[model samples]
Target chain A: MSRAGEGHRVTMREVAQRAGVSVTTVSHVVNHKTEARIGPEARERVRQAVEELGYRPNALAKTLVQGTSPFIGLVADSIASTPFAGQIVHGAQEEAWRHGHVLLVTNTEGNQEAEERAIAMMLQYNVRGILYSRWYHREVEVPPALGETDSVLVNCYGRVGAGPAAVVPDEVDGGRRAAEILLRRGHRRIAFINTTTASPARSGRLQGYRQALAGAGIPVDEDLILEARPDQEGGYGIADDLLATGATGVCCHNDRMAMGLYDTIKERGLSIPQDLSVVGFDNQEVIAGHLHPSLSTVALPHYEMGAAGVRVLLGLQEVPAGGILTVPCPPVERDSVDGAAAPPTG
Target chain B: MSRAGEGHRVTMREVAQRAGVSVTTVSHVVNHKTEARIGPEARERVRQAVEELGYRPNALAKTLVQGTSPFIGLVADSIASTPFAGQIVHGAQEEAWRHGHVLLVTNTEGNQEAEERAIAMMLQYNVRGILYSRWYHREVEVPPALGETDSVLVNCYGRVGAGPAAVVPDEVDGGRRAAEILLRRGHRRIAFINTTTASPARSGRLQGYRQALAGAGIPVDEDLILEARPDQEGGYGIADDLLATGATGVCCHNDRMAMGLYDTIKERGLSIPQDLSVVGFDNQEVIAGHLHPSLSTVALPHYEMGAAGVRVLLGLQEVPAGGILTVPCPPVERDSVDGAAAPPTG
Candidate 1:
């Protein structure tokens, strides 16, 4: 067996000599430069010589002549630590491949220095474009280096008309969809359990919930809206308060919180969709599908956002500079919610 | 704002003129060729001129001269779909960066054609090394292109001495540790709940369970061992049979199964530590830590394996060709297990 990095590097000149063809003919064949014509017999000889010698075309040399690298750069804020956002990289890689490009990826872990350094490295490589992304959908301070590159932002937003294009999830629409799922099931006295922290997702989702309530001729009951730590424990802690409001249905900030609510409801001798119905955001399959009744939630459009970012960067889609493209977050209906049980008690 | 890909390509001549120096002097400064003699004042002028002009040293030109590319390649199988393995990419990227090389990554989704294509692309880029990995620990037919590149296998193994090195988890040791955790808690009657499918994890864990029982002077009861689907439903379905064996404790195949067991035990009006103690494998935080009593389990060393693969490929560590490195899986003690409550009825 041949070992890599241990043998003398094979040269194109050697391949040309072995094939009895000019170096230019070998170069044209190796680089896929189809404009240059060569006899069929010579092409076959060159191919066989290349194969026998295990010759690999140097991309760096090709880039110097072509004025473009065959690589795209991806600078992720925190890919490994956040499982929910892994699809973003997957989407970007697939899109880049479709266009005959490979991805050079860097995980900065939210370090500003690392982010700048990554961008600089991409620039040095002369990558055709760069994709800047975060683990979640939110506003980001555009990296200063982005001003020097053809870049797109994923799962994040930047300044309007900024040099880089932005692709983000339609959080407000997702929120409205969550509320509409509950309202359509005939629950007007529905309550929303949101995160205690101030975030775009929190505000956008709440706004959508309000819009759905207003469109249905139901007056907003501010008292029914509550906040929690956004985990199972938080959901467990606020369960009594949620039930005391007498709302037959509830929309949670995320699936983790919804799971916690399930525990409290089961402990109180209540059945899902019967005594109480629940809807959640972020339809994480493992948590949502594994629940006793399964969870009805909103799905984050991570894959679409990632694919879109690459498309916009590659000019496959037209996106205005500094403009944000909002991808829709659709509902993944499960067995958690049902039609309204009884009229509102309050 | 200067948009990337739409501006005039800056040349070293322009930077040299701006710095009032020769192009050769500017080139020496930009490429960090310390052997060249240049005064501090001239070097500072070159640096400022390069930064002001936003001149990027051509990596392609440098690679053609140096005979090596400044990047490493990683080909992953289904990274986004399997969140548990995100750490593998993270560890690889970090290690690559520490060595002043960036990572070019691709996700093949287990397609033989795609895997071969990805490797071919990586080779074109002249990557210094390639790290081929999978989402799970299993045997994989080595890609044919691997013979032409420096590569290592992570979380998976290939043909012995097939030229590529391998780094994988020590599954047998992990299983032994899991059974030891249960036995140390004074549980003489312990049942092993494993997967119905034939897998390395299942067989390795079962062997460890037998070893622990033998060392404790206890006979291995065939009836006490059971096989299920290795999921929540499978665990739930096998719960009745598990309890009927009169075992005081259970060592589950994985956390998902243990969670199902928790559901069954709860439905039977039994407490976790008081009525039946449980230990699980793969301390996946979402499932293991979120359980009511929290699950005590063993953690697969994915991050370590990933980091080690890169180290071996970069020649930072010595690993014999075709050698497999087994990393230890440590126990993550949580709240699930406790001292045995009573003697086994059987």
Candidate 2:
């Protein structure tokens, strides 16, 4: 070990000897425990000794004494690769810090072996709790090892009674909010651009769209509902079909799709919120805000979900059995939508 | 503690008793350290006993025995908020895992007190090494406490002899690469769109631009260089100034600015790579790829810097004293740059 390394390993005993006080006094001063019994001069001496010796209390020793580690393990699918979803890690970490806990994050990148290994490692460290998160909202198979630890799921859910508490975005509500935004702008004929694949988000958002139109007493136009890959290319590929439907408003499954739709609209010489109004889900800042006329969309409340997951894991909040919670997705109104123009008269 | 927690606390002693082997044999089997003396049958018995009893060796105890922790600490300014830079954390964490180490990440968000607190906490756990990183590449003040530990800086540097090893993107080289791409495409009348700030990136990139132009024996035209805010609005704001210069190609500080320049060129009734060629730095996927003519730009080596930082901190690679290392930034060729139009006939 280097000199610096040796210096870092300074023992509390050294501080106690230097301060001419008992080891308990040094411990009390360092841990900020009750020091009232110690005289002021002794306490000051202990503090000075600690500073001079650079003595840091061993977290490992503390954990063994307290029977709980001041660390929470966050097992993420791939926070670094996910652009917007990284907020989940940030929110959970900040929340952990607020409770005097540090987060130990590991990215499994969707590998089952890695997930199991990470969970096992966290258990070895006696992490107070674990937050298992996915890069995107979806179903996940909870690692069996995770069952042996206090844990919560973020942005993902597992089979009932298989995992700990989970907090996820309310995709259905987000879909409804997107439709409602268009509807509030007086567009009775709203089209929904959904994903071709079967996903919780796809189905949930579709359900919300249907419910919103049904509540508005508008006859559901099956022809206006289109399915494509939930990306820019998918939206671009389906643009002609979307325009052909004659719907004045379009609600996309995500911001990427909406951006692609925006490109097609501009290429066709149609103006945004003038010839058509567009709304997208997931208020991805880079995509939504950078769009020419900005995208009005639904915000996924990822921060709230992450914070809630940590709270549940730390016992700061209670969760119902089978441990699934959905945080609301709110509407973020931007320049992408406006009141529908009066119907063209012959 | 829950039943699961109690089960997780099962000791190696119990595993050894169950396997009918000595504690030392069980330790050797579990740690995969010098098990050659133990018969295969004994190893199999220990493994089975461990699995059956759910015995997990405490990392804290293991650290005490090994004199080092199998964990690295990453203290970041704000990873989640930085879109593309998240790759840095990902790369570091992945590399750490490859070496049988996990990264414990904490975000300070530029709060000095939080930084000190985070560093102190990591020291308490005796992290094997620390990777101190910032969201953007710039000079940073090395927290005095960091000197007491094995550490490295990623995407940021510190005062001379003031901190640990550092790995940062070679911004000057990136700028030169951006200019070289345009020059290779037959653009000598290239304009450099620089940032209006006194940032290291701005000055370093400008220096590279000048060096490239000078190396090519092209007289540096003062009129060809312009300053902007290094964002879309800034690029848009300088549209007329850039156009009036009659430059055949433009190199922007970043992709956002290039996208703005693209819009301006198109709105001016000009075609990309036909009327004018464009190049940008930092191949930001959302902005660069989504442009009509995808941006040709320089890629910041954030991932490499992060991985290298970890390697240096772990002593897996050597770094010069004073601890400054520069990773290469390569050019990502796209459709944005093309042969400059033949010099206008007099």
Candidate 3:
């Protein structure tokens, strides 16, 4: 772990001396060379010492000697365009780099054919693992050939059961966080606007909302929920419908839909957090900041989700064999939500 | 070039016969493997026949057999939370796919050390080429060891004296487009609000504005141009400065700054395209559609820039070594601009 020009770092020689092994032997063990013929007892000693000293072998030097890679093949469904997809990539890259692995990204537009092509490209380069990124939470038909490789699906929980591990955000928790924020502001009559009921993100979020409401001794009213796309127009369309139902607060599935709702509220001659308080998800910065009143949203732990995905793929985390890991969601308060201050009694 | 399970597509065998070569030889050439001992005349003849027949080799079958990859490594500075970066990535991915190549992405966060690591990872994985994406147009210190590989820098150009090919949006053209859009709408006193003159994008854009004014026979007014960062508050500050000078139009470096301008304009009791006209660059979608008036911006031709970058790296296009290729910019006019009808009669 000692850098040539740096001080206050442990040297490989330290591990070698502690493990009672030659420097070359220590190097071989450190590099994880399968061909290294060290005795089991010596290997055990070196492993213990390496673990104790928290030694991280130089990936560059080791890769040069091995003529191969310690890199993970991360073919995102989309990198530049999709916020959710990009966040997953950021997380995976961070985790991979932290664990001495580098992530190679491919932007596939979530097409099965494109996904296969990306996977084949990864295989050609002998990438150690694969991470498939989807635009949102949905059933992704895992590429059949990925069984031989270690992979972690991001955002979407893949349906290919035994192929690769996956990391997905807790939409339910996101919904709950949204509800919690509204309830804490001493408001009830909350409405939910979702793009579609068939979507996992929407359904899971609804479940969290209902759970939160029930926990707070409030009735789960189906009449208050409005299904719509997570876009400005969709939210706008639903906003009037919800306002008609006499709801004072609303939680849109994601930020885009919330933006539409903001317009809807404004056009209806209603002031945010006054006539109707609003809470959105997926704290997208551009949309959040520019929206006249600024949007209050549930900040999905996208970065952490990405790091978790890579960690699971590297077998560094105890993710289940065929299960989804739901990351927690935290609420971000902005001007969108209103305080339900009592009217003057005069 | 044969596609199985489809009705009579031109087979590779036919191409071989037309060129007087074996099927295997045709396959080898199509797969980018020139290792075989084939005569130059025969190779040229085969190439002509394939071109004449418009043969598209089955990338999947070729990859399966020869293990040849068409994966280009995309090293983006970071797309985790940035909107513009994502657009560049989307554009690159689209173009890469058109060229029958998949892009692998790595976020380096503008860290040279991370860039080196990502490059080393790409090399270890044997990527065909590299597309280094930067957040801004500036001279970045490329990894010294990148000499062994071919690369194309995106959004940013390369070194003055040396290094990889590059394809960036024509900042001057974008600036000109913005200027013309505002002018066409009858905005005479236009103000240019930029982050800093030191920024290549800002400087290039300013040059474009000057060029446009010269074309229009309008005098260049230094008082109208103000330097500020491409952030919300910066735009607001610039807007405040521009309004004090009685400028009716504002052109910002990017959309984020433009958003700030909107806030400042609102605070000053000015209506967009009425009291003041505002146009922005980057065409960031979040602010484009969601903003009240919807920001008018100069489209950066992200798709063309990305595709052109791939073309440059794969030698699909003839661009000069150590030179910048500017992609054309077009104005997307929205609610932000209003035609300046005949001036009111005294």
Candidate models: Cα lDDT each: 0.82, 0.82, 0.73
On TM-score, the stronger of 2 and 3 is 2
Q: Sort all candidates by lDDT, best to worst.
A: 1, 2, 3
Candidate 1 lDDT tens digits, B98-191: 8888787787777788888888888877778889998778878888777677888898888665657888888888887888888898888998
Clashing pairs in 1: A161-A322, A162-A322
DockQ of 2: 0.48
Which residue segments of model 3 deviate by more than 4 Å? A1-69, A159-164, A264-270, A289-292, A320-322, A342-346, B1-71, B90-102, B124-129, B237-239, B263-270, B341-346
Model 1 Cα lDDT, one tens digit per residue, A10-91: 6899899989999999999988778898888999999999888888887677778878777788888776666556788888
Q: Write the per-residue lDDT of candidate 3 for residues A1-346, one digit (tens) a residue.
A: 3222211223578789889999888888877777979898999999988776645454434453564556688777766566667777787887888888767677766566777777766655556677776767777777754653567777776655554667778888888989888888887788888767477887789999999999899997888888886677678677557866677778888888887776556555567767777888988867776566778889877788788878877778887555778788888888877775432110
Task: Give model 3's docking category.
Answer: incorrect
Residue B67 lDDT in candidate 2: 78
Each prediction's DockQ against the real complex = 0.54, 0.48, 0.19
* lDDT at residue B341 of model 2 (Cα atoms): 88
After TM-score superposition, what is the CA distance of residue A130 in candidate 2 from its true location, in Å?
1.7
- Which candidate achieves the best lDDT against the true structure? 1
Leading candidate by DockQ: 1
Clashing pairs in 2: none
For model 3, residues B52-126, the per-residue Cα lDDT tens digits are 665555443444344444667888886877756766777777778888777767787667778787776665544
lDDT of 2 at B42: 94
Per-chain TM-score, chain A, candidate 1 = 0.91
